[model samples]
Target: MSLGGKISKDSALEPRIAAIDLFCGVGGLTRGLERAGIDVKLGVDIDSACEYPYLANNDAAFLLKSVADLEVVDLTSKLSGAEYTLLAGCAPCQPFSTYQQKSGPTDERWHLLGHFERLAGELNPDFITMENVPNLARQSVFTKFVTELEALNFHVTYGVVNCAEFGVPQQRQRLVLLASKLGPIALLRTKTKRKTVRQAIGGLPPIEAGEAYDSDPLHQASELSNLNKRRIRASVPGGTWRDWNQELVAECHKRETGKTYPGVYGRMEWDQPAPTMTTQYFGFGNGRFGHPEQDRAISLREGAILQSFPKSYKFVRKGDPIYCKTIGRLIGNAVPVKLAEAIGKSIVAHVASHSGPRKRQLNDWHD
Candidate 1:
């Protein structure tokens, strides 16, 4: 049957596919997919912390369950009666990250990909997508995933995508895969200009270290130590600790091995895209998370903004403390929303191409 006939008459009137997001941390992928006209039915994640933001930002149910515990029956219930269904699983990438190269293969998170593969085999939805660090592409697990999908008669296409190229204001690279049972599918090449850090968060009002913006709770920075404050004051934008005075240099950096890790404890350049944000992005001592002009580390909200999350995306409620560690983990672990939007658009285009006259009729109905 064609893609259009899979829907009920009620759903055909709307003519959009339904999606279920796995590992849907804070609804980044759901938000983007919805923006591309897909109806996101539910978001699943193990962390109870994700419930607030995921439900706050998207019109979807949040299921606090690990992927291992999720049953196909539960997903099918939510996705039932849709024109087509999409399954998105962006498994955590720490196990395959470049920083974890030495210990990554041994990390338990390595098996999560295998779990996702098994789930996909069981469900076999109309379309599937996954996003992860580019380092995942080099692993044997990645090849096995592609082979399994093809074995299921899926037309698969995957590539390492640069987030900046899709309008994200961070220089993050991720492996993105899109597979379809309907027809051949590939990610659309967006010709938009790359976004810079200044364009993303330049307009926010200033706040000091250890201070929260009076207007927005998430716009708060972690407190820096007295010595770190002095180190930041001496540091230049785009420059590392190597530029700091001898007194401010960490003893670790004084060693020859540490000299090669220059990206640490550095301020981001205003005109450039930011370095990839990590779970520790709120700390001044981690990566190049320091503010360009401000003498504090990038605030929690700044990191979220860099991740392409809306400034109004609420992660905490009033009366709750906006701890740096909690909010930082949510932002850093999210898929860049803009990149997800691009993937959504690509899927829409692919389905439309295969739908032929039904798609044209739907377009005319909308117009």
Candidate 2:
């Protein structure tokens, strides 16, 4: 059965357009799209850990299935009655991430994009979007995916977008693709003012490492080893382990290769956007996650805020012990919500322009 079909005119007259988010980790993209007036009907992810946050934050159903195992029929069934459908599949990006050891084509995750391409071809949704590490733009997989979308008669546009340019308080660059059968579409222009680390999370009540804030559980930082604590005490904001006294240096940093990773064990500058948060961002030793003046690594909430999640975004239920690793992975892996909002707005504008007065008439009828 074809994926595209109309819901009742009464439903179409509503203000929001509709989308389904594939590989929708914790519903970051879905949340942003909803904020920009798109109804994200469903989110699919392989990790069950995503279910809580995904459902808690967005008005959507969560499917705990790998994209490779997902049937177009299943997706079509869920999305069968939407007036305009957007299929967004931002497959696992670890294979293309610069921080990862280059696994090349051998990585199984590399093939997940092919699955996304296949589903897009089968569903032939009105619009398509994908986001990944900017390095993916240089890979053959990205080229093949774009070519396949074009072959399906999609007008595709893609570029590397800097999240800091779009109000995310982190220096993350991502490859964003927007394809539509309706007509040409592109990302909205960058915002004039960039958000800084101070602007994003500077107001949070302070908590020591290993301690959860009394009111906010996610604002807890991971505890440091005594040695690591000493190292952080000496580390300057934006300065690496090189600034440490010889006694405080990790033995690894004395090696040639380790010296090159100068961003590690570094403090964030209060006035600047934070460095890209990796899966291990809860640890002080990972990347530049240290707080500018707090003498502790950034808390889980801080990382989530940097990812542009609302300060109140819930990742875990009350009374549950917040595991740093689990929460860190969720926060670090999320698409910056602001970036997704920009994408959502662009899609909405494209549809509004293409649909023209018919959509306006529908709105008038509803009014």
The candidate scoring highest on lDDT is 1
lDDT of 1 by residue, 297-342 (tens): 9999999999998878878776787777888998899999899989
Q: lDDT score of model 1?
A: 0.85
lDDT of 2 by residue, 85-122 (tens): 78986889899887677677888898999999988877
Question: Each prediction's Cα lDDT score?
Answer: 0.85, 0.84
Q: Count the backbone clashes (under 3 Å) in each candidate.
A: 0, 0
Least well predicted 10-residue stretch by lDDT in candidate 1: 3-12
Q: What is the TM-score of each predicted model, taking all chains together?
A: 0.92, 0.92
Q: How well does candidate 2 match the true structure in TM-score terms?
A: 0.92
Clashes of 2: 0
